[model samples]
Target chain A: MHLYDSTIPSGNAYKVQLLLSHLHIPYAITSLNILATPPETRSSDFLAINPNGRIPVFILDDGTPLIESNAIMFYLAEGTPYLPDDKLAKAQVLQWLFFEQYSHEPYVAVWKFRTYWALNGFEDLSGREIQKLKERGQAAIDVMERHLEGREWFVGTNYSIADIALFAYTSAAEQIGFSVGPNVKAWLSRVEGTKGWVKIKKDETGKCPL
Target chain B: MHLYDSTIPSGNAYKVQLLLSHLHIPYAITSLNILATPPETRSSDFLAINPNGRIPVFILDDGTPLIESNAIMFYLAEGTPYLPDDKLAKAQVLQWLFFEQYSHEPYVAVWKFRTYWALNGFEDLSGREIQKLKERGQAAIDVMERHLEGREWFVGTNYSIADIALFAYTSAAEQIGFSVGPNVKAWLSRVEGTKGWVKIKKDETGKCPL
Candidate 1:
């Protein structure tokens, strides 16, 4: 399997890369620039593979193209220790995944996009953007922080993909100018301390698909 | 299980209501005006139940509170026909769920919010808000149109939760002032004609969560 990824770091793409490493699965990576005007993903060739023009798009062993990052994570980790055994626990996992998408990702991810990669009045990160990032983003973090106050992971007692999905962008949120209070910061360290955990970064070749 | 849902006619919430009726599971519906200023979800009481302050939160028989409409749908439908049994098929199901969250929901759902809810020019929409919605939302619909050129369902030639999730908002999209191309219109009809479907507006005397 090969992943067509973006070079510029994206938390969503990083989730897939980290999962592959954690599982010791071998794969090739290709880099694309999502920040480029008329993103490289908009190109006809890339669009042929994914009409959505997003990443990290995982081409499975049989060459099936999986576009959404969380979907790819679920595909790779299903039936493994990374996914839960109890049906309700699995539903809990999906709960967090949905939370990340609807709440955390919308606020924090876009804040990261504007503050890091696409900073400009054209994208307009002033006033309401900053306000929303602070309000909704912090609200999302508060939910996670409160949940992590006593538990080691989001769903059950183990390290599941729910943790991986939420951790991908959150660890580096400071770079995007978002704050993680004490509770979330402590949770981050706990997650990092887990075995088989890997930091999402460029490979030895200094390239990855975004 | 009792559901704190409203009759404001949300497609996301409708997915749960439809499945509950099909399964003959009794649930209570609680309606709130999500458009009201400082939306009712932000109330201290509602936040105590769901800090994320969103609607269609479900309370299980054991009093477990499940937020995120899709997560609630999964919780209700797990181990049932609503979820596929095949491994790859199930992953495909989740693939659409993730897609609905990241791509479809943000775009189509937002379009509904801005159009139907009279939220477009409100202080909430802001200038940048409309821009991102127009660009990204249109792109999302374009991708769906391309994907639906020939396929009836999103995956595996059957009516799945993916259809329910997407159909929820996509069906009511016209009321929200968004136009569905001929392809999506036909797709909507196909989904509406499926077995075990229900309209967004249930009987006025629908049970309430008390």
Candidate 2:
């Protein structure tokens, strides 16, 4: 299988890469430069693979182009030890995945884009825009900190997709100009201690080094 | 199982409510007023039920509080007609759900918050901030329009969770200050015409009349 990702370490992309590493799935990675004007993702070749033109698109061994990152994670980890067998537990995992995208990622991601991608005079950044991003981002962080109190992971008594989804951007909260807080900071360490864990940009050739 | 949902027509909350309606499951709807400063969701009583302090939290018949809207939807629909039986097909559904969160909902929901909650006056909405929001919101709408071309719903054949998730907001796009293009506007009609479909708001009790 081949995974097409981008330079920015998106939580959504990291979800796919994390699952593939944990499951020890053999896959090759291709990096696209999204920062480039008319992003490489808009190229005809990439669009043929994913009409939506987003990253963490998985090209299956049979050449099926699977676009959403969580879906790629689900496809690779289905029936594996990482996925919960209990019906309700699995739904809980999906719940956090949704939360990561809805409540969590929006705030954190826009912060990162404003600070990193949208910086450097590429386009003018207004003071009001930055203020809103910071306010929204902080609100999201507060929610995560409160929820992590006394909890090992997002789900019940185990490290599941919930951990993978949230951990992707969360570990790099500071880079986005936000803090993960004490409880969530502690939870990050616990997630890192998990066996077969991998960082977002650790590979030389973008392949699973493990 | 009983479902505790707010009176507010939240897209995320409606996901769970819609599924239960489709299944004809006996459930209770608890109206929560989020506009109440120190909202009911933030109170200690609700916190004991869900530490996350968010609405659309689902409590099972046994009093297990399931937070996150999509999580509750999947939990209710698992092994039922809502979730696709085929593996890849189901993964496709999950992909759209993730897309709804990461790409679709952020811009749509924020635009809604600004318009409905009137964040413009609550905070200073400068010309620059307004322009940026419009740009971002239109980008999101364009993406949805491109994806919806020649399709009745988000996925190819069935009206799965993807439709449910996206329908929650896209249906209300205009009210939230988003312009639904010709394609998306047509698709909205098709979605509402589905057999088990329900609208976001209720007449008096703010309960889904299904």
Q: Give DockQ for candidates 1 onward, in order.
A: 0.69, 0.61
Residue range B1-210, candidate 2, lDDT tens digits:
656666556777877777777788777778787767778888999888876678788888788778777677777777886778787877888887777777767667766665655434426666766676677667767877887888777766777777788788777777656777888898888778877777766524322232
How far off is residue B153 in model 1, in Å?
0.7
Candidate with maximal lDDT: 1
Q: lDDT of model 1 at residue A153? A: 82
Model 1 lDDT at residue B208: 17
TM-score for each model: 0.90, 0.86
Per-residue lDDT tens digits for candidate 1, residues A71-108, read 78878888788988787888888888888988898888
lDDT for model 2, please. Answer: 0.74
- Best candidate per DockQ, number? 1
Candidate 1 residues lying further than 4 Å off, grouped into runs, are A119-123, A202-210, B33-38, B119-128, B202-210
Fnat for the candidates in order: 0.79, 0.79
